[model samples]
Target chain A: MLDQKAHKPHERLAAHLKDDLSQVDEMIRARMASEHAPRIPEVTAHLVDAGGKRLRPMLTLASARLCGYEGGHHIHLATAVEFIHTATLLHDDVVDESGQRRGRPTANLLWDNKSSVLVGDYLFARSFQLMTEADSLRVLQVLSNASATITEGEVLQLTAAQDLGTTEDTYFKVVRGKTAALFAAATEVGGILAGVSEDRIKALHDYGDALGIAFQVVDDLLDFWGGDATGKNIGDDFRERKLTLPIIKAIARGDDEERAFWKRTLEKNDQRDGDLERALEIMTAHGALDDTRAAALDWAARAKACLDALPEDPIRDMLSDIADYVVARLN
Target chain B: MLDQKAHKPHERLAAHLKDDLSQVDEMIRARMASEHAPRIPEVTAHLVDAGGKRLRPMLTLASARLCGYEGGHHIHLATAVEFIHTATLLHDDVVDESGQRRGRPTANLLWDNKSSVLVGDYLFARSFQLMTEADSLRVLQVLSNASATITEGEVLQLTAAQDLGTTEDTYFKVVRGKTAALFAAATEVGGILAGVSEDRIKALHDYGDALGIAFQVVDDLLDFWGGDATGKNIGDDFRERKLTLPIIKAIARGDDEERAFWKRTLEKNDQRDGDLERALEIMTAHGALDDTRAAALDWAARAKACLDALPEDPIRDMLSDIADYVVARLN
Candidate 1:
């Protein structure tokens, strides 16, 4: 087993890529500024400088380094990925009416929804401009297509919310759209910029996709797992009526009474004081939480396996550890 | 003089490029479809089919045709431009909390702000994808830069709204961002796709920029010009407290009393019934309205002058006539 007391995978990766990460920070700061509208920078800086781990951009940097890339465009792609992420966070907070994000007041709350909306748009446009500067049509295609998928996923999540008919298939689609698309694109573009072979690029894409899925599944799991150290409260997703994986699994295996319970709590948004405990009891009784945990582990394993196709570099090892580290919170 | 009864310039352009326009329509319908999210197409179709003149896309088509070039990619660029416009309209309604657009209930009003915001994002991403299909880095740069400028302008407008300190320079920047950036990009990309020379491209760019400026100036003027055939009501800008061209001019020319009225009406947004009339009277008394009209005419003339650089074709004549038609309402 790895030394858990040692530096975390992302921290080690950040150390190794210290220069590149700093360059990315520089690029993000430079690009987010607006000559005409100071609000663009204000709203963007609030989110971009929020203490969230720069995991996505790190993935790009790590992937490019692992693929033997020595060029600077990876920095551009990494900054672009972060910009897209920041933009989406701004918009998502508005959509979810979220007051806080990354333990800070969201841009939507700090400013108004209008600032969040318009500033999100500005960042998106900025991202588009940055990606085009990469000057690779393939890179443009990968990023642009991922962007479409991400937005499509958000829309699907919106429509699928509070609907008990949301299948596991639809759940995966939403997860892919909301989380995995950019992750995959982030890694895939790194490989592309490195002039790596198609197979290697595919492997990187698969690795990022699996890693993202595992990351989100753990996130959803932790939301209900309660009392974990992730700073998320128990049953927050439940309060929001989000139809996540465990609930979807529970709904599928639920007895008539259990299904009715879900319907009342989720579909109808009618929850009594004891409903959270009862819902957890039902989920545990049906092994739904266990199954969700298993699915997350499987994805994490798949992510690690995809890394084997890359060269045996320290970066690759860190990437594998990152996958494990994502699901390790469950332990 | 041409027979005004025969057809509007846009109508003539539309008739001339009916096949291209229809192809653009087909592409828009096809591309706007979301395999998972039906709401995307539903919201998109509502705006796309709202029977507003497809003026921007037609500019793209006419520019390409006038450049003596033939290609299918122009259709893609045109559709991409339209998608950008539609996406902006969606977000604008949400930002403005508007209930109506193009004489139809807005997507934000019909569905919700969430739908409008997410669907608009989806359309923006879709536009990004379509523009990449044109397979030119330069095209990507142009469209992406325009997208950035457009969003920047919007954020500026959001911040600049109701501020009496907004200058003519700031007003033009806002106008470029909100309206003219896409217009210039649309026409510029047509010449780009035609593989035209640098001077021709510059001419196309200038023509589009001036035309867009004129188009928006006329739009702003009409919002307060009060009673023409256009469906817009007078003083909409005043009611919204938006700082448009005429108001900027009027504010610059206003004395201390006039400034107080504007500060009360626009800055503080406190108004009784006659405030709109008083605002108009102040504007007319200062010749702000007339100067605004003259400015619009200057831009229209500039747009027509730019057309002189391109080869003489039926489309060229139509474009010049279109410029004239844009400001013809002032007569």
Candidate 2:
């Protein structure tokens, strides 16, 4: 079954960069340990061991290798990327009050909100320490800026959560900050560490940015797609009163009755039974899901097109395949 | 009144570094502003404008100036230090469930925990961006390590809260992490950016660490000293079940009855009307407050002594005065 999964683009990239990935893992384990705070490791181990796809770090590894870089700093960079992702997830769980993540009880749920917040902070510091070791001022700038962007996006999402007036522009801005910023930084720093040209580096950034936007759109669509495919309960977004792309589109095209339903369920958060079903119906009636899927496909195509600027290599092809794979679920 | 306040050592340092301090303020206001997320600045302004003395940034500026260094990077470093301090305060309020800080309602209270957490994260990222602009990898390493230490200390404090078994060693470790790490980093990074000798940098680190320990010990002592001098209600730490030095000392020396009282009040968190009085009486009987005061003075003296290694500048004198002023309240 594991070998069969290897046919996936990200998995193929992982197979190609097996040694570097292991080194990244080793560095993550080594750095996450704290002599004073045993709780830090216990909380982090629960999250890291749950085995998310490690998609962000894999992007960094693939990008660097695709540019023909042969040095250990890429490992540090990759590990740093993963650490940032983990840190954000830990904090996000607390912010979202999420009970489960990656199919396991979240750190916030298992330990407490205090542990999640502080441990998330610790991971962020660790990520910076790793990035500093890579000795690239430019990489530090990119990652730190991305960090700021991610947090800003999260804050925007929080403020926009139940507002029926949330625009698609605001939705895109939030997605760019919370998701694409890190993804773009992850790949851009790889090209940067490899001493690639400005054009190629920009191309890598564009690819990652588009891929991340696509990934998040697909995720939001999956939340309303009514399936067990994403390992999440369908309508979780509606239950949480989140303002994602589909809901935003539906609101834009909604009738007065539909608008009243959204205001009662989302804006006012007086959700009743069958509210999720009603939301899905309204979204489908407005063709919001179809438009959202079209947006995801558009981003995926843009991501694949950006890869054309990179040198022809197996890693590049895998990256292109990864872009396609991100939206493949929608098909 | 302002001039009278200026006689305070930290105020004296601020007066001395007026130009640079203004520049730090300017940088802080500039960087804290988010183009997309208006809430980020709104939450940050509530905390930043509350005006908590800005001691950490003053340390960074004082260290650099005392080294006779001529550079603009110190402003960035000082701003970064302030940002880091602000970030921690935001997160700390959430973890402590604090309603007020610096005699003002905390950001977490004014907004929410989610806002505080995400905005705190934004400030941290902003701090890193500021640090990278200073362009010294060694400085980054010291500051990032301090960041890790600070978070670890906070987590340890959380795990150790209300536990009767928390040792003095554990107490010191927690204090070192949550308080001294940032202090040490703030000062050490100044020296590092100034291109000072390793020996002088070590001295700066020691000065900041000792000063921070003294500051925290004094704050904790003020909590039980039964006065409004600290702008906090007496026995707040007791109500929160925080095992500070005085309580840790009292617990170690308590008789069976006293031990049971502590276990019931602290460990079990069962308290009645006279519990605070009883707790204070037990601490007084055991000379815990006296001993804790002595500990603060000792650390203050050590902080002052570390400054002797630097050149005899007015800034150095101000630094020594700051150390002495930290513990002078105990008298």
Candidate 3:
């Protein structure tokens, strides 16, 4: 029953933003087309058509409207947010050597890494093009800074992937870069385009940042014990040796033998039979899963608190509910 | 002797822009550094320090200065141009699976494809960030559009690389996308920053466009017949199955036997020991090499003619001489 509730808020939010969401969708379709390079549209279509929730762009639109943005540039900014998100997904799949994303074959898997990488670059350039069309220098600065942060987060992730010495602070920095930066930008730009007060803009950014962290934390926790509703095989992160929050927490408290097990399984990438079960057991022994869930819930609560700066409206209520729903999966 | 003279004009232009070029270099060095991700500078420094001519950025500087504009923002725009160029080279090396660039092991070969793709992305984002710092909406539009065109050009080049039906017109389209788009943007933005007349802006764009076409055509010609002074082995393009202007021309005029040869060597990517030599023989037989050289000269002439819109000045004289030097490699 709780799991069923998790899907309701985003759907309702999408419906609330239906007209603007549709505009964003149309903008995405029009912008993704390539007049000369057919492969760009083909590769982009495969991912765009894959049933992503379009949650990020929806957040941008909702934030803009919540702050009383009347102009049409919100659509452009929303579409730009989606493009940045999609471009990162394309490159992330290649970097991870992933085969499936959103329960479909990845762009890199279907076409090639070269196409995925180049097309990702194209979408990023297109995102810049879209952002400029918004006619706001401040918006450009925020999004460009977010883009740099995202890339820095990715490079940090690559270097920090299998190392056992990765600290919790470093983990948060990586998450902030890879996941939360764009979310913050997505919402912050919405407030910016509306010419909202600086305090309100900061509040929107904090909301998106906390929501993104909570989302990623829950996603990581689900990787170990989450059911199929997460659309990922349990323990996938363990198998890949990614040092997520739970694993890092577990390793910090792990005994010598447990550390050796982690080194063998993750650092060395020599995963064996029963490794997944052992990882789960060790994580449980250290209470890592519960702590990670608690952390996600705390972030979700923080995200909800940031909405107090905004005027009461249906869109604002939806954002608050979306935060609650992000951590509800932990139940 | 002529080839040696070809290298002198660029050096002279660099000298002319020494103060601005030094500032641009400092900006590049500063922007490329990353506090979180150390690997970014490592990969970027490998290419940035590889002694590239910095011709694109120089055009930006020269155009602005020649238009009698005095502003500090030209350095930012010029640096942005170089960042765009470097980012493309990094991704291009990955897409081409090149082991060497600028006579050293490429970033992809030295590190891995993952680093190359991600860092290329970092630079693109950095370029966007740099463009925004210049304080001009029109500058943002020109550079963003150029960024999109550059990526599209790369994607077009990917799809069109080995196909035999790639015509002269298609080759120009691909070249324009891959090479001229940025060049045109670089010079166009310079004029815009100077707030020059519309005619001068168009002239700057046309000059960059024709100069880039001439540069690429001559580079393609040199790929087939260049001596060691060009720092490449002749026939490398043929060995790689690239359909440059000469190969496209030869394919267009070839008889049935020659068409079959192209089909086997290019489309099929099947090559024997004598294939490069034989390919050269066929191109000669069809006079494709001569025609390609003539085309390069014509573009160079067009590039020179565009400069008539600018005032008579030393910078204009240097630009005209650079065009002549581009095609001098054919001699």
* Candidate of highest lDDT: 2
The fnat score for candidate 2 comes to 0.86
Fill in the DockQ of model 3: 0.69
| Poorly placed runs, candidate 3 (over 4 Å) | A1-7, B1-7, B98-111
DockQ of all candidate complexes:
0.74, 0.77, 0.69
Candidate 3 per-residue lDDT, tens place, B118-173, comes to 89989989988998999898899888888888888888887887899888888898
How large a fraction of the reference contact set does each model reproduce?
0.82, 0.86, 0.72
Clash pairs (backbone) in predicted model 3: none
Candidate 3's residue-wise lDDT over A3-78, tens digit each? 3334578888888778898898898999999999889989999989985899889889999999999999999999
DockQ winner among the candidates?
A: 2
Cα-based TM-score, every candidate: 0.96, 0.96, 0.96
- Candidate order by lDDT, decreasing, is 2, 3, 1
In candidate 1, stretches whose alpha carbon ends up further than 4 angstroms from where it belongs are: A1-6, A227-230, B1-6, B98-111, B227-230
Q: Of 2 and 3, which scores higher on TM-score?
A: 2
lDDT of 2 at A322: 93
Stretch of 10 with least lDDT, candidate 2 chain A: A1-10
Task: State how far residue B5 of model 3 sits from its true place (Å).
Answer: 12
